[model samples]
Target: MNNDEIKAALTSKSRSAKLERRGKIISFLCIALIVIAVFAIFAFVAVRGIATFVGTKVTLWNFLSKTAWAPGTTDASGVPKLGALPMITGSFGVTLLSALLATPFAIGAAVYMTEISPKWGEKILQPVIDLLVGIPSVVYGFIGLSVVVPFIRNTFGGTGFGILAGTFVLFVMILPTVTSMTISALKAVPRRYREASLALGATRWQTIYKVVLRSATPGILTGIVFGMARAFGEALAVQMVIGNAALMPKNLISPASTLTSVLTSGIGNTVMGSLENNALWTLALLLLLMSLAFNLLVRWIGNKGAMK
Candidate 1:
C-alpha cells in the first residue's frame, strides 16, 4: 500500500479507539452519578434519623420504658429525662385507630369501583378520591382547625387536641392511600381464580371473598402497611389537632403529642449544641430506627407469606 493510504488507515483506527474510550468513560460516569445520588439520599436519612444521640449514658432502654416524657424538668430535685413513652404511645395509638377506621371503608369503596360500578360511575368517583389525595396536608390541618377541633371540643369534655381528634383526622387522610392500594391490588388479582370459584357454584360474593381476596392478600397487606407508615409519619395535621401536649394521654379526649410533635417543640427550646439538643437528636435517631425497623418487618412478613 502507498504511504498516504497506510497513514490514513492508521489515523482512522486511532480515531475509532479514542471514541470508544470516551463512550466507556461517559457510561462509567453516569452509573457512578446514580450510585452516589442514591447513597447520599439514604446517608442523609440515616444520619438524621439513626446517628443522632438519644442517650449519653445507658438510659435509652430506661427512657423508652418510662411513661412520662417530661424533658427539661422544672425542679432541681427532679432530673430531666427524655422518656418518650407518651409520644410513642400516642403516635401508634393514633395510627392504629386511624388504620382500623379507614381500611374497611377503603377496601369496600375500591371493590365497588372495580367490580360493581359502570365505566361512567368509576370515572366520576375515582377523580373525587384522587382530588382528596391531591389536597395539601396543610389544608387538611386548616380543616381540622376550623371544623374538627371545634366538633371534638364540644362533643367531648377536653380541648380538641387529643388522640381521638388526631385519629379522626388521620382516618380521613389515610382513606385515599388505602383505597388506592386496594384498587390496585384487587385489580391485579388473576381472573382465572375468580372464574374457577364461580364455576364451582360459588356466588359472586363468595368467589370474590374466598378466592380473589385471598389471592390478592399480599398486595392488600402491603397497602395497609404503607398506609400505616404514612399515618405514622404524618406531623402537620396530627399536631394541629393533637393539642401538642407532652403528657401521656389518659383518655382519647385528653390532649397529647407525638415524637414528631416533641421534636418540633424542642427546636427553639435550648441553645444549639447543648445537652438538650443532643438528647433530642438522640430521640430523632430513635424515631428513625423505629420507622426503619417497622418497614423491614413488613417486608419480612411479605417474604414469608410469598414463600408459603
Candidate 2:
C-alpha cells in the first residue's frame, strides 16, 4: 500500500477505537448510575421505615399484629395504635382475588389467540388488550366508582366500596397484562412440541392442556406474579374504591383498606417525622420489599423454566 492510504487507514482505526471506548464508558456510567440510584432508594426507605420503631416506642409486634390503626390516638400504654394487620389482609385479599378471577380469562384468551383463532386474536384482540393497558388507572377507578360501586351496593347491600369493588377494578386492570404475557409464553413454545404431541395421538384439547399450558407454566406464573405485584402496589384506584376504611374485612362488600390506599390517603395529612408519617414510610418500605421479592420470584421462575 502507498504511504498516504496506509496513513488514512491507521487514522480511521484510531478514531473507531476511540469511539468504541467512549461508548463503553458511557454505557458503564449509565449502568453504574442506575445501580447507585436503586441502592440509594433502598437505603433511604430502610432508614425512614426503621425510624418508626427506632424514633418511637412502637414495637414490631404491635405494629404487625394489632388491628387498631388509630395512628393519631394513643392506647392505655401511651403507644399509638398503629396496627397494620387490616391493611395487610385487605391488600392480600384484593390481590389474590383479582388474580384468581383474571387468570382463567387471561389463559383462555391467550389460548384462543395462539391456538384457536390466530387471525382474529392478532388483528383485533391484541389491539384491544393494548388499549386496555394504555388506559389510565384513575379512569379505571372512576369507572369502578360509578359502575361497580353502584352495582355492588344494589346487589350485595352496602356502601359498595370495599374489597370486592377493588378486586373487580384490579381484575380488569391486570387482565390485559396477564393475557398478553400468556400469549407471548404460548407463542414461545416450539411448534415441534405441538406436532410431537399430535403425532402421539393426543387430541387438541389434550395437547393444549397437557402440553402447551404445562410448558408455559413458568411464564404464566411469572405473569401472574407481575399482575399480583401491580395489584398490590396500586394506590389511587384502589383507594378510591376500597372505602378507605382501616378495618379488617368482614366480608367482600364490607368497607376496608389496603396498605397502598392508607398510605395514599393518610400520608398527606401527617407531619413528616411524626409516628404517623413514619408508619406510612414503613408501609412504603414493605411495598418496596415486596416488589423486590416479586422480582426475585420472577427470576427464580425464569431460571427454572430455562433448566426445564
Best by lDDT: 2
For residues 1-308, write the lDDT of model 1, one tens digit per residue: 99999998877757678899999999999999999996876566555433324434425575676665555552344545666788888988998999999989988888788766737657977998899899898888889888888998899877777999888888989898888888888898777877888889999899878887777787778778878888888888888989888788999989888877778778679665665665566666666766787698779867965885
**Per-residue lDDT of model 2, residues 100-205, tens digit only:** 9999999999999999889987887899999999999999999999999999999999999899999999999999989989998999999999999999999999
Model 2 clash pairs? none
TM-score of every model versus the real structure: 0.83, 0.95
Task: Measure candidate 1: CA RMSD.
Answer: 4.1
Error of 1 at 254 (Å): 0.2
lDDT of residue 118 for candidate 2? 90
Root-mean-square deviation per candidate: 4.1, 2.3
Query: What is the lDDT for 129 in model 2?
Result: 96
lDDT of 2: 0.94
Worst 10 residues of 2 by lDDT: 8-17
